[model samples]
Target: RRKAKRGQPPKPTPPPPVPPIEADEQVFAARLRGALYFFSSAKNRNAFLAHPARYANAPPPTSFLPPTAALLGPEAQALPLARTLSRKLGLVVLSLDEAVKWVLQGASPLAEILRPIVESGTPVSPLHQVQALQLRVSSPDTLRRGWLLLGAPVDGKIAEIMRVCSVLPSRIFGICAQHADASIAGLEAALKEKRLSHRLAKIDSSRNPLAQQHEVERVLLPLLRLRQQAVAATAEGEAHTAEGLEVTDDDFVAKLNPKFGFYCPVTWLNERRLHHCGDGEAAVAKRCAAEYKGVYVCCASDKQLSAMLLRPEEVLAGPPLPSPLPTKETQQAAAYGVSPSLWAELSGHCPVTLARGPKLGDYASRALALKEGKKEFCVEYESKRYVMASAECMEEFLATPWKFSRLTLPSKLLPASDPLDVGELPTRGYSEQTLGDSLKAALTDLLTLERPKYPTLSCTETALKFVALHLKANNPNVRAPHLKHKYSSKLHDYTERCGLLDAIMRTARSNGEVAAHSTASAATDATEERDQGRPGPEGSEPDQTTATAAHSESAACKKASEAPMPDLATLFKAWDEAVAAGLDIH
Candidate 1:
């Protein structure tokens, strides 16, 4: 190529070709003292640089490895660590289904039945699996063994099972739910392969095994910690076992790394020279030398880190747990962020319109309809009424009236309300009828299922939960207003009352006693007529029953009706039993 003119610099060479590796040459590589490099194209190098896990092999043919070798990578890297830890702890892992079948009376009976079903068409029912679990845990001997239950999931009923166990004050230590990034196609492929081959199928050769190990770690942590707790409680007189602390394995890894003092506190990546380590860094640099996979740090040396990485549950013994459940006090405090006022004062005697929120005419030229056309449902807050375009929106708006009341929804006012006049919109949305009638109509339409199949527990809490479950089932985003809202109180109280009557109605219907109750109600009406001696309407006359009939019937009814509504716990217990009884679990 000809050289450039004297003033101009020579043109740079074109991009270099990727250096192909020889038969014996390394395919990928990284450096500890400097940035990771690749002999392949820039894209390949960049990809590896971004995430070391992408290329981390379980064990290289040779001992040479980058400093960050034992990172959050190919899960196979964790197997040896897990095996070492399990051996140390002396624990046994129980496949939940096998354990269930073993625990159940007459194992042959279930196996013979399930085998044909499995061979024919239907997969083993998740419900049956749960039943097997119930049987397994019921036995006292199963609890004593240092064992773990894994792999039997009962569809959407894990919550229900936990609810049932909660009644027994379940001895569960911790649950680690691993939320991993895996494609649907990949999972389906694995399942299909397993079904077709009749052998073990690995979904993600890298991630799945690590996930299983982490789950065991989460459970083991609590089990070991609780034993310590029991020892301490012996002297302190306080509860020893800390139950129900769910944490992820990755989070545990992240937390433990801080104690190791090798990784940077801020970046959470392994550190370089003369940064945060101080005198400890120098001591590490001299006495300990990081070679290949082993990273020599002060708090934990290479071999120590390898062991800790597998089972760091000990360092996570006591408090400092993340994400505690919210309390009533905290909820009440949240409401106090803004001032509270009466419905009349806030609505200005206008119908509350969820379609056009409380802030309708404040900023824009006029209140306008949302992109979607208006829907239905009108409710009242105390005396002033509010209109929700949809049942769901109304639920959300009512759930926290105070928050919504001070603000407004985006809207365009009707032509009649032009000029954005002094007063809020007129009461056009809510009907002139009594608010109770309107609310009842809406609720009746809302509660789709029959009343009698309901749990025989407290109606108050159950009804509230049922309504929430029902609403969310219909619309995921449905919300319930704060307790302070009169609408909320009214809706909840109404639901409870309806639940009681509906329960009675359902019982009467099922028992074929509706005819008897009607006859009784009619006879009682005649007796009241006879006592009052009032003339029948228009020209009709009434028949009479025994004098003692009304007294006995009324008194018995009153006694039966006076039973208090059950609480939420009792309701869930009843629901669990009711659901379990109906499942096809052998």
Candidate 2:
């Protein structure tokens, strides 16, 4: 090493060369597939070599875990399960017993209080146990990676204490045995009493260790992925801010049209984040024109969001909307309805038939009179002319026009405007037309399966009812059946060929009955199980049967996990497929 000058730093010295080790004392190494791995002992190396295929394709162990999680149950069950989770998820396991022992070894006030009880081998109270565990987990080193608490009693007092102390785990899992011990039963009772069963997932102790691990992983992986994505999004947002790419107030204002404000259903649906439309009407119109389709406008006005599905080529050829967007109240008034003002505005010079006659009072008689073309009488009210069957009926209607003229608006004139509630707005990126077409296709397929002999009015009406029900299920705005009348017209000549409509109706009724019966039976079973003081299946609340209650939930979770995180295009595609397959849009 060279000596340095007084004001300068000393020169670094070279490390000494090491002697080569004997081959027998060298580290064990092997190549599996295309990757190299080193093992501390020959036993592990040999194990890997024995099943290279199993080890080769396995996911590399990850240290990622949920922010906080807890495991509760008997020592015999919880300890092993905690260890398994620790290995699987790279979590820090902090056992209550170990925490207690650590606390007793210290001079903390909680330790002083617990010392006598612990020494006597008496069970520590939930409060004291929580305090000890809190003391251990509060250490920065214990929570560097996320932690898994072990062997904590599932008591509300402990949970409440932990919450007050700001140390509550984000997730809790309880080990449940078919034949529970006294302590286990007590824990379950506390869970039930506190209504904390929903917060705790029961892990069946009878299943194999691998199955247990898989269940925990299944519950945890999605949450971990979601958390990771959220963190990544936050990081990206910060990065954008640092890079001066974040949207400023001025920038946001600049994106708006000043006259016709921007609205992008894509961002609103997929991310639940609002952004000004990047593409102007001209650009949108051009794109729609190129595709030979009209632009579907999603309008956002005060307290309401509405979507209008324009017919093809309407965007290019139709007149522009009026300046200054209309209020929801005005728009509702403008719609042709029972409002007399609306009738006066739209009646113009056209004449309409008084479908209901003041004297006839019956639908059959009115239809017969209309068929016979008895138009000798007429009355004018609210600038609208109504043709009547007889002079007496016209005079009677004129005497009290309001009473006899309470007519529903024709379906065609009732604007197919779907008003979406802010809370229940569509989060899936699907156009109204796409959804309707998919539904129509599915119904057509089902009708084909029925093999109808000839289309009948009854069949068309039944199909219309089905479509209305399906639409109402998806969108609360679709209250009336008139909006789907056009779809029924298209199918009117292709349904109810040979009593197929009756068969379809019967099947729908049967399905509804079966579903109702199953739900009632499950509820009864759950009530019986609770009354008997028996725990239900794993991952279910005391009032729920997992086999039934969890079926729909697990299916939804599976779809969410398997599907890619939705963007506009992907969500639209997924929604189209779901609708076409006749799956309920949960």
Candidate 3:
């Protein structure tokens, strides 16, 4: 135990080995992808933001989804795609509650949590946050290829398709009256008779029997190539595991047919295409070659193309997707050239745009000032002043910008020696006092009074000076010129020195203080003084203390020789007679 030898002394056995932690890259990556994909779709993004924790443990089901499907559940179907796509986009896929918690802990940008994973290094992939998604499904093969070949699960394809559906118009059917060799009058007559020419408008407006078919083809070409690539990849992935095992499942070629539904990039719907082969192998490819098994594109009498998709087994095993019987409503939509799927997509995503605005007011003001060479007459409203060319036009106008337009507010006038004449009646209304005329009236009153001293006008010092000037001008005989000259400076000095007004004000303040102290002192002296003046509680005569004080005061007064006392009885009789005559004591 005491082996303390050199360096090799006590190389104690390392503490029990700790198990290595598992890397969560794949799981985290998948979650991130899901978050980005959800945010990319307007519908899903809105739903999440509205109820952050709604998707924490679970979310609500969207349109056409079964009740059994819990929309908010973390394990819900949308998550699979969300995880994968989030990885592609480089976004973080944590629940809204988690995101909020991080933000509360001083996390910045808020989007940082979702951004890194969504933008993970993919060039073509969309960012974590997107304004909208436009879904354009051209073929079934595209969907099949995206799912089977790119290792994308059905959920992932569904998520992408949902996002793409968000930006399309709401109504699938568009209508236009058909005019084949008909005059405008004839068309008007037809309309009056409840008849109109119509045809179904495809969701992809670029594609039809004619016009822009090449553009449609151009966009569709890539999907076709991808389909081929997907097929090859699936076959390779399958063969590596198949070894020499013979596959007996050959229902593929028998199930071949073209069918369409809501398709987005990298996703398609095909019954016999493939399913997970299990045992870690790609699903076997099956052809959709069955006769009369294609999806029915129903065109109503009005030209509406409404789809009634047949069951997967029906399309794959024996029959084609049934053509939907067109009702009056469907017919009307088709007549207008609107596709149901397109309409659905459009309604799913609503887009809005607005025009740009003009420059800021300050910038405009500076520009206006620069345009005029000299400083123009101006007045400030709400701390913002702008110059105008003329004062006569606006000098007396009210500048209420909130109620009136800036153009309506007039410019102010600068003082001049000669009496300034306004050019015309102002477009805006104003108060005479606003024209700096209040001081003139006050001064006029001060000078007309017969009193020797000036009356103090309760107003700003600026107004006082103007008032003083009027007094000096009107009362020339009095030596009040010096007083007028000193008025402004005296007012200023008085406000600064005593920090108060004149004698009247000081007297009023002193009286208020004296009254308050007297009230308090009277309250305190009440018990002692009440006994000396009034009778006791039981109606006894006045106390000895009061009698003694009265005697002392009477003696002192006698020694000084004061007025004679009057008889109480005589005084009472006179008072009674006065009362009888209706004389008031007050």
TM-score for each of the candidates: 0.24, 0.30, 0.14
- In angstroms, the error of model 2 at 143 is 1.4
lDDT tens string, model 3, 413-528?
Answer: 12223323454435332334243464456655545543222223334553455455554444435566676567556544433322222333445456655655554454445445
Evaluate all candidate structures by whole-model CA lDDT and list the values in order.
0.39, 0.51, 0.31
* Lowest summed lDDT window (length 10), candidate 3: 348-357
Q: Sort by lDDT, best first: what order?
A: 2, 1, 3
* Model 2 spans > 4 angstroms off: 1-67, 106-124, 177-198, 238-586
When 1 and 2 are scored with TM-score, the better candidate is 2
Best by lDDT: 2
The residue-by-residue lDDT of candidate 2 on 1-586, one tens digit each, is: 2445456677555333222222444466776444577666778777777766666668865343245678876677777878988887778898777888888986888888999997898998767777888888866446556788876646656666775566666567777775664445655565556444444666788987778778788777666675554344344331101111111223334443232345433333433333333223332221111111111332323122211222222222333333222111223323434523233322321122444433445555443323111223434555444544344554444434555455643323323334455555464535443475657655665566453332223446656655554444445355567755645554453433345434544554566556655655655665577667775567445654454564564445445444433343554465568679998644
TM-score of 2: 0.30
Distance from true position, residue 421, model 3, in Å?
Answer: 12
Better of 1 and 3 by lDDT: 1
- Model 1 has a clash total of 17
Worst 10-residue lDDT window, candidate 1 = 63-72
What TM-score should be assigned to candidate 3? 0.14
Residue 52's lDDT within candidate 3 is: 46
